[model samples]
Target: MDTFTELFGTSPLIWAILGAEAAFWILLFGGLAVRYLLRNRRLSTIMLIGVPVVDLLLLTFTAVDLAGGVEPNFSHLIATIYLGFTIAFGHSLITKTDAWFAHRFADGPAPAKKPKSGPAYVRAAWLEWRRVALAVGIAVVGLLAMQVMVGWAVPSSFAEANEDVIWSMALRLLLIAGIWLVAGPVYATVFKSTPATDTTQRVSPASDTLSNHR
Candidate 1:
């Protein structure tokens, strides 16, 4: 059995690990640039769907290669980090990147709107709190999924296990919560009305974009 160390050289599984890291980063930054250029958040919005799909496919291939040619390490630590990121950034791209752009790029004035926090607001927050609680939970689940998948690959006992289904759902909820958590403040600050001044600050063009998105 050629362990990942022997196949890849003195370093244990370096190529496999590095390859995965590089792929993840490339996809992340690539998506960022893409969303920025497109001037539409939905491209990133679709990343939530596309990323995990790609990751799942990649993981399947990695596992086959690892079993045939490498080792995910005898300890499953790498799997956790690898899979955690796939889920996190995948989720973030979908839910939070728009917020990221909004917060970073917002420099305009908002159109006037009444200040109102209705019951729907409270209800939305209440519903979302449960989702926010799932961020770490989703990460944990993803880590566990990696472990489970690795376990199955070794023994060929792969069951659907309902875990991936659960993860898909949890990751989405986590993404929504995370986007709101970071972007919420940005939304509040960027969109909220400021008193009209004698000196008058007109809306920044970028702010208009942000407001339109909101």
Candidate 2:
């Protein structure tokens, strides 16, 4: 117990967040397994419902830790990011996973392939970037709320540590948002023009041959 506390520090919220993350995946796959393999929709619904409950549990843990005046650490930042991304993207993930499970276990249709290139790909990329933006926004809001709760004072070592941790987290989030924007939207926009160049090159040979014959 002493070692465990030492490893995670005095706050149990870190451990709780870890457990919640593990529980989320377990419940997701377990629910799908029960639904498709065992053909038990009722039980599966119960298990799948438990997935969001796990998120709530993590939120509660974070809130309690902060309320108790625990110093903000990496774990708190992680909790905020995790919650943000999960809230923003969890449903899509669950739907995609369920489709795969259905195909594998229940003889359902195969999942549709994601677009790889062209306008479709660009649109998908933009859509994904929007989701990334939403997630980042949520995370920023969460960090701000935490700061508000803890106040802006640095009268003590804990307050200074908290400020440092929060600043690092904010910077990390900004880096992520910027990278996603460039990689997803900017790259996709550039890639969308490549097909036009390739098509023009392919047609240039035919145009030269026709002119020579004339």
Candidate 3:
């Protein structure tokens, strides 16, 4: 234990953050593989939840270290909450990116496409914008919750390290929202031109009757 502590002694908190980062990717890919490949949603949920549990371990350690009068790095707190956001919101980002790629290049049906022009184009743009808005809203809520947890855990140390943490987080959130908002319009443009194979036009009864008469 002495050697172990010595190795991480200089930056125990950074080590914790590194551990959480590793946990995040492992949980994401592993959970996705189990969820889709094995088709075991229950197990997948467990794996996904386990991602944040890694941070919980770090939190436990940090709290203990603090109690022992050891100074902890503030980045450890940020990394904890950062991983929480990844656990909470990463799936949505992944799903959306997958969908966008599929629509762009896949041979199957184009799900997001609409009529090329006129009111249909406008409507599709509006709907796409709304979807982006919803994602932004979910992300904002996740960040707020994360901030609250950080606020509770390392109120003094975080402030000492960076008094503008709240503003930093806010600006980060805004940058995320901005990216999505810009992507919304690009997605809107892509959806406006429906693929020929994707179109589903119903024949009118009158046309059928006329054709039969002929």
Candidate 4:
């Protein structure tokens, strides 16, 4: 355990890898849940935000290893394959046909008749931007950026000194924070709340108050 912990530390790459694995499990179970319990046609989406992180981690790790650190070994190959599959799988989870089409539109309260529409989402906050493909594009871009950064910053055959490691940690944390900050506003701007009705799509103050009441 101690050795494994040392190998991993809290590097963003590791975090991304961990997140990816967690997302895979979450997605797998989420699918099963939706199928058996949720009844496949339900229009619920899963939040495996970790998918991007994993993809980034894999790219970075591969870069580091190839740059002349430890020669690629069996474990390395295994990881490579794992990350590859995760990226493909994760991508599908975020943007898939069965996810969007099935269930005859789930049991959503229905899209509310709204006053205005913008950026597609704020037009209907009650309805998530998950339906939009652009959000997935954003995630893909972020993941690629992270992957390049890690590859350039740290060489596979190289390990940083304590101070450099600390700096790396700080940078990774800053990135995570930045991504969330940016994503929040984007998502908010895209997802607006409207009136609540089976036909009216929106998340209103009434819903909030009602949930709180419950």
Best by TM-score: 2
Candidate 3 TM-score to native: 0.42
After superposing candidate 3 on the true structure, give the runs of residues whose Cα lies further than 4 Å from its correct spot: 1-9, 72-74, 77-214
Residue 150 in model 4: lDDT: 46
Residue-level lDDT of model 1, residues 95-200, one tens digit each, is 4654654455553244334333444444444444444445456545654555565553222222433334333344454566677765554444444334333566
Q: Kindly report which residue stretches of model 4 are placed more than 4 angstroms away from their true locations once superposed.
A: 1-19, 27-50, 66-68, 94-105, 108-214
- Inter-residue clash pairs, candidate 2: none
lDDT of 1 at 60: 64
TM-score of each: 0.38, 0.80, 0.42, 0.29
| Tens digits of lDDT, candidate 4, 1-214 | 6886666543444454566677666665565456546565343343334445546766677567545444333234334445544544456555453444333345434333434435444533423333233333343343344445445344343245223432333344346545654464355564543323367667799898999988
lDDT of 3 by residue, 1-214 (tens): 7875554456567677777778777886777677666768899789877866775776676556555654434453454455545545556655654455445544434556446665566566666566555645544554455445445433355445345554455456567767766666566566544533546787899999999999
Instruction: Using TM-score, rank the candidates from best to worst.
Output: 2, 3, 1, 4
User: Which of 1 and 3 is ahead in TM-score?
Assistant: 3
Report the Cα lDDT for candidate 1. 0.52
Specify the highest-lDDT model's number: 2
**Candidate 4 structure lDDT:** 0.47
lDDT of 4 at 35: 55
Displacement of residue 59 (Cα, Å) in model 2 is: 0.5
RMSD of each: 13.8, 5.9, 10.1, 16.3
Clashing pairs in 1: 108-204, 109-203, 109-204
Point out where model 1 deviates above 4 Å.
1-13, 38-50, 69-76, 106-214
